[model samples]
Target: MPHSVHTRSDTVQPRPAAAASRGRWTYRLGRWLGIDVYVHATFLALLAFFGLRAGLSGGAGAGLEQVAWMVALFGSVVLHEYGHALAARSFGIGTQDITLYPIGGVARLNAMPRSPGAELIVAAAGPLVNMALAFVFALGHTLSADAGQGAFNAAGELAWPLQFAVMNLGLGIFNLVPAFPMDGGRILRALLATLGNRVRATVWAARVGRVLALGFVVAGLFGNPMLMLLGAFVWFGAGAEAGAAVREEQLLGASVQQAMSRRFLTLSPWTQLGELAQRELDMTLLEDGVFPVESGGAVVGIVTAEALRDGLHDLGPKGYVADVMTRDILCVRPSDELSGTLRALHGRTLAAAPVVMAGRLVGMLTPRGVAAFMGGPQLRHA
Candidate 1:
């Protein structure tokens, strides 16, 4: 909880970095157990397609009923993700958010449990939730056979309980397939990590996953676009996971002070949008045309290029930099390890981080600087 100050003498110029956001398009379904649930845009399209197809086949009533079943399926998917979230929580790993996609639910954990035993529990919990749901639904269908009708309704639509049971079973089985970003692959990684290096374990697991994905792609060659897409996702996801594992290992011995940029520009809180607008016109001198906002020689916040442009349009060039700056941003210490620093920057919009120590502005850390250090020569050696 202690803070560190960043100084100008430690500055290192930043490099280029890529960025993207997915949470923006998601619709919040609800929050529980201190976690938010989101349904992705594509999920709604899936529901619309299923409902329309059912309407064409059976009518409005059938469409509504089919929609209900689909809802139950997604509800089960949400439950499955919750299983992972809760289990990860038990290990002190917080989830970022849970997002439901057309294929299934994804529990985005803030960080994965490095302990093999902890990971095993988290990975297995998801499949177990589906199995439990399958059991409950199967029991309901059996008990309601005489009263509510199990298999066929008067409209010939498959009844809810039985349908849900089968769907849950399928979900459980499908997720157990060994592929990256899936439970089975995580399970595999954990098991292998128990026997050897974590990075090496990830590489082996990724290889297995890519091989498994190839089989799916082969099967998809005949048809099954969904499976083909899933296979492609698995292949790429596995490669990414492997790369992340290796990257983490490489940065383990490095510290933030070793790579943070000390030569970056700063903006004054009193600086008007006109200054930033002018700077934006010739951005060759600034990385990403963004600068940390300093007030009274202390880093207060950051002013980004986009904010400056927007301010210029809305408030004209007279808008103060403070008006467009993002305040209350997370700061890093000079002594912090590079890996922890990178984790702090995860899912953040602004890739630049201000380093502070003893309540004084020190230097700025940027993803480009980190990347350069990792991929290029060491500063002192160079």
Candidate 2:
């Protein structure tokens, strides 16, 4: 299953907008089918830890073998994520990237499928891949056994192929345990959505996931550390999903114009940072940290207060605003739905986005603006 909870694609953080979109700690493993693949640093640590543990218990060969198995297992996980990505593609949803973590692989879809039927198909695709892999492995084992090549050697331990087959089978079944954050949980939500109200369906699915999480925690208490970790992940993931659903419902029917800041400061790209600081002390300016850089009646880029301050310290007072501004701006239309805008801004590091219409900048949208709008009567009615 594509582990979507808190994945890099949707995990928002306050930082410099100029920073690269990729996770800082992850290493690129190249792109496949236009989707960038990354491996988290912790995944390497996991491999090292397991290999060392196996080496301590058995020998160098055993350690190498264990490492190989781990690689194969995660390879299967990558394929599982690809299954989800390909299925979503059929529904016109693009996957941003796939990242491998210690827990699993995550395929960050650009957006959730708009229809419940499409969602169901996308969610089920991951587990179906695992099931297919398991079947192939099982068949391979059976064929080998029929040819007198037993699945076990003189040590009576199952061969790696047989073990891999069993592992894939377990993976497929476990992911189908109808709980939130899992493919099965999404399947359950999609089914419930058919009864009306996607928000209500998410709530019910979250409730079921939390109950199952408690069960996993209880089962882990008997001696399974992995089960405990999985339980915690499910519990938190369910809560996050439920909360997001509620927020989306609240923002429904609202547009960017309703919440955007119409009155704000705009700086010329050629303005010196030192001069800007002096002006800041001389007059009362917009309290929002972001300033749109405008030139020739067109918004060019954005400069944050933090960036300006840093520029003054690093480049003395002579540094131009253009040097500190982020040129690759994320702009939204005033007529765009607030809910969808928020989704687009979710993982972006920008403090605000320029609201543009017909090639003209009309206003700016910031977190503070959104918060104020959320507390207003319009959102209450929504």
Candidate 3:
């Protein structure tokens, strides 16, 4: 059975934004309906592994047939993810990309719908697609059977159409297991969110998911290694979802002013990359790598230590900071909620953003700074 994972765009970790943006270990398949699709390298290995196993048991023809079936199944998986992306699009949310992995597919949405109803619709879309596919495949199987075709092929295996139909049906039902990070879990969370705070809902959903995951693991001990893998995915995914929900809740209770760095270095647009690099070396203790560029008494852009190093090496140390600085910068207000502002920064995949008020740069905010604040005594006690 195939499953879909939804990733929120705002969940940025303490890593280089450039590194975070790169699609590592995945090959671009192409784009459809303004959404890019990628297949992980491991997916191919999975196909090869299955093909080899089938070949050893049967023959080359069986191996080829199995590979074709797997491809078709994953094609259905892709459509499953598209179901999620298109549904989110209807809610005015954009998808970053859809990547197919050995386990299943993931649709990275710019943001999850805030409304419970909207979230319920988005979460249910994928399984609905699978169920719809199952119906179509079942109809095809019925038609083929009525036309004097056997359910099993000459190879004594189930007909491809029947297999597809059963697989889609299983996919639809398995994903509705109400496990956190799964469609059913999201549906449960959405329904629970209607009654109270979303964080509490998420916590409840995660607890249920963990229990189900443990059941899966125990059942897998009898047979089915795939079930074991799925159990692990559910276990870890639920924990992550619960943790993120709590972190988001904590951020919502704080303001940018409480977490932002009040003391930070600023640079002139005319500053040479060489000079900036030397200053960066001197300020080795500085935790923040981003520096706002001020020109004519206004913040113009921002540059990172990575950019400074690259500029020095590429432009021979004489390149102006303006040449390398990013002009399209995300700026947050001092009064803005840290949660929302952090989401904006992560949506843009920015490493850091400047805190501006009254057209003046008051401070800087980075994921690291936010982590420090989140770990501080004030939030710790709360």
Most accurate candidate by lDDT: 3
lDDT of 3 by residue, 55-107 (tens): 98999998998899899888988888899899999999988788888888888
Winner by lDDT between candidate 3 and candidate 2: 3
Specify the poorest-scoring 10-residue window by lDDT in model 3.
Answer: 373-382
Q: What is the lDDT of residue 150 in candidate 1?
A: 45
- What C-alpha lDDT values do all the predictions have? 0.74, 0.79, 0.81
What tens-digit string does per-residue lDDT give for candidate 1 at 265-356? Answer: 77788988887666655565443545789988778898667677788799988889888888967788999987766655653544668989
User: Using lDDT as the measure, what is the rank order of every candidate, best first?
Assistant: 3, 2, 1
lDDT winner between candidates 1 and 2: 2
- Per-residue accuracy of model 2 over 246-286 as CA lDDT, tens digit each: 66666789999998989877889999988988876423333
Give me the runs in candidate 2 sitting further than 4 Å from their true place.
5-22, 147-154, 262-288, 291-303, 307-363, 374-382
* TM-score leaderboard ranking: 3, 2, 1
**Model 3 residue 186 distance off true place after TM-score fit, in angstroms:** 1.2
TM-score (C-alpha) between model 2 and the true structure: 0.76
Using TM-score, give the best candidate's number.
3
